[model samples]
Target: MSTIFLAVGLVLVVEGLAYALAPSFIRRMAEELPKLADEYLRIFGVAALAVGVGLVYLAQHL
Candidate 1:
């Protein structure tokens, strides 16, 4: 569906911008990611997922 494509495109744009604008910061995060505790990463990922779902819900309703 068009909505799915739009979501993917928007994600790519945002991700690309981050890499383009701050390649060093991105690399640093990637390098440190493996050193982070698994539980901490899992919690952060779930929180991000919740925020993403909230944004999608708002976009649809508002």
Candidate 2:
């Protein structure tokens, strides 16, 4: 559906902007990611997912 495409496009735009605007920062994060524990990363991922779902719900209702 169009909504799915739009969501993918928006994600790409935001991700692209991060790399374009702060290449070094992205690189540093990537470099340090491996040093992070699996548990912390899993928690971060779950938190991000929750926020993303909440945003989508708000956007749809509001």
Model 2 lDDT per residue over 10-60, tens place: 999999999999999999999999999999999999999999999999999
What does candidate 2 score in Cα RMSD to the true structure? 0.4
Give the alpha carbon lDDT tens digit for every residue of 2-57 in model 1: 99999999999999999999999999999999999999999999999999999999
Candidate-wise lDDT, in order: 0.99, 0.98
Off by over 4 Å in 2: none
Per-residue lDDT, model 2, residue 52, is 96
| Full-model lDDT, candidate 1 | 0.99
Query: How big is the positional error of residue 2 in model 1, measured in Å on the Cα after superposition?
Result: 0.5
TM for every model, in the order presented, reads: 0.97, 0.98
Number of the top-ranking candidate, with lDDT as the measure:
1
Candidate 2 lDDT for residue 45: 100
Enumerate residue pairs that collide in model 2: none
